[model samples]
Target: MFRFALSLTLALLATQATAAEAEPRWMVTTTGGAFARDNDQAHSFGSLAVTRKIGRGYVSASVTRFGSAVRQVDVTLPSTYTIGFLSAGAVHGAWFYDGYVSLGRQHYKSVVTDLGERDVAGFSHSPVYGAGGDLGAVRWIGRSWSVTPSASLQWIKSRALRGQIGPRGGSEFETRETGVTLGAGLRVDKFFGASHGDSVSLRLTRFQTTNASAALSSGMRGAFNPSAQSGRTSDAWAEVGASATWRVDHRLYLDVGAVRTLGALGGDMTTGSAGARLLF
Candidate 1:
């Protein structure tokens, strides 16, 4: 009867396209690390990320690099380069929401030591931007375990610390900050293969700030304002990690990790990483 109802509607549309290709819309990650900060003295960074999924919502993009320290007392006087942009979607099924914006640029060259005579310093630049938003929720608690919680808000524009030390000596300064962050994490996957995967995580993060202050003068109204400069100098940091992924076949993949930065921002910082991931 009419070819058996057109072969049962083409076998139910090929079983809904094989259940949407078995889920997992997209994912890509790459990381590299080595960092230590406590008045400056360690460097190494690399990052690449991409995530995509639409219909339940998801989107992401990232790129990062930070490495420059050959000597000069481990450099940190003014070394920089950071860039990020992200967007997210998901209003159900584990809940999700995201937003991100970042930009940073700073170069170095500074030496101001009088009495013994040593000069020739000129290199200072600043370009900062910020925007942030996050609200995430995930729960699985079984078969591999999973739990995630997140909250964030950020607004910063602290860029103005130029340099020059001789031939007229130059300088510049400015600061404006607003931050709030809260995070929670737990992800354990042990090990799984067919494509390879391993995971371990423990995280805790906290940050608070408001209004900030810092100003110097020569061009922007001879600035210099510092009246008690808010509160809570620094206190809150924790990150534990373990990650591994290997799928060197389908579209390439490899990731390794290590992280440490427990308590304090003016001292104590550690990180280690390895990476290679490509998917399309």
Candidate 2:
């Protein structure tokens, strides 16, 4: 019994020493991607994220931007959108969880502008915000490959301002909507190299949303009156994507991902992304 206890104590000390030597307590990543839908124009997006380890968890801040142009008959519309995010998350054993909040804006060129102003269209703007949580687990099947399944839920709200030039000179309308989205997905990862290996991943996801918009007595949405819109609507969507990460060294990796989103108002969308991560 005495010998066994001493051996156990030595083993515990060795484990502690190994963990203390692990590299990378902080990381930064940036990603860029583009999406195109059927009968609609293509849009490009990019994001930057900074993350740091804290105890058993991590905290991150991110910013994202999107740009696009759409053509309607002889009129052309161009727009820009942006999002800012902050997240706190943890990976414990085989399970991980991420909780985040995001603030964003959407700007789109108005196709409803006056006929004479078709060459220089008016613009509509929407301010959006959301809070969400993600949960997942990593399960390794062998030494070089693993799989993860995840589920996420989020609440998003958007208030849009539409402006156009009219016979009255100019007019604006305000519309507000809220959405609760739920998603579930699975990913498979394959790893190469001996230490801090390069990896590739594939994923598929399905989602559903319950949406509500405020409508007015005129049957229009987003009225200043409290009772204008008291009801809500819903929708469902799905997506599939693949990504790969190439490890440049112990503290850097390059990333790429492509995904297709389905069941949105316009149609299905295909998007591709590339990025890099640095650890220190």
Candidate 3:
């Protein structure tokens, strides 16, 4: 965790050092939602990002944290943290490309339960790493509107045991997955009393998996065949979200939004969030 934080701090410093003198640009967002049948489990996430102009493009970095808790159970899962590095290619007229790589770490905790006068529990932890990249283009459609489309791929590898039932009876597992995601959105400038700099956006996205693997330690094995494993068990689903950002000043802003999954993923996983941003 310390290393991740340090890396992000250095990246931010380097970006700021090379930034051109212009209007401050930065974003911070927080989101929380529930998952599971009947919304029995809840998840929360938050992120901070900053962007600065460099040459004809932009450089940015962001840090994020997310965790989940059960509704009826008193157990809270460990939180995960991620740091990202981003580069935006020079704009060619009205088109450009953006890419990013991210490093992530997941921390897990033991589960605890109380039955009559007995307390039962077990705990464990693991660290996972992943990288992802994206390519996107934006084109002006008219005076106050534009369209952006993007595609992204992500992969993650598990490094240790992710869960446990008891201290003495636990197994190690590793996971690998690759995902392809596509997104399209429309941006409208100066809507609902917002300034020209302020914008509202509606976006739809779909994510599909091409490969997935789950490997267990020799001592802790399951009947599931390794050949039968696939990266994603569920089919692709669409997500729709709306966001509006209002600038309180050149350095301060507010952003809010709601996102819901449109198909199968929607039944148990939907999220809504709002947050603030500060630039320096």
Write candidate 1's Cα lDDT for 6-120 as tens digits. Answer: 1111121122232324544566766666565445556666656677656555676765656432122211233445646455545455555655666655454343333332322
Candidate whose lDDT is highest = 2
Clash numbers, per candidate: 1, 2, 2
- Candidate 3: global Cα-lDDT? 0.41
Candidate 3 per-residue C-alpha lDDT over 1-280 given as tens digits, one digit per residue, 9 for 90 to 100 = 1011112222222223323435443433333332222344444555556666554456666665655322123322333334343434344444455555555564554433343222123324444444544455555565456566655555544432233346765332434443333333332223333334355777666655443222110100010012113234434445566767675764565666665555543243455566665666
> Could you give candidate 2's per-residue lDDT for residues 159-267 as a string of tens digits?
5443444796655445577767677888787767635356677777776767623111000001111111223555556767777767776667777777666665435
Candidate 3 regions exceeding 4 Å error are 1-21, 25-38, 69-90, 112-123, 159-195, 211-234, 265-267
lDDT of 1 at 184: 43
The ten-residue window of minimal lDDT in model 2 covers 215-224
Off by over 4 Å in 2: 1-21, 68-78, 107-126, 161-172, 212-233, 263-265
Flag clash pairs in model 3. 110-123, 212-231
Off by over 4 Å in 1: 1-23, 26-28, 33-43, 48-50, 55-58, 61-65, 68-77, 87-125, 129-162, 165-252, 255-280
The window of 10 residues in a row where model 3 has the poorest summed lDDT is 216-225
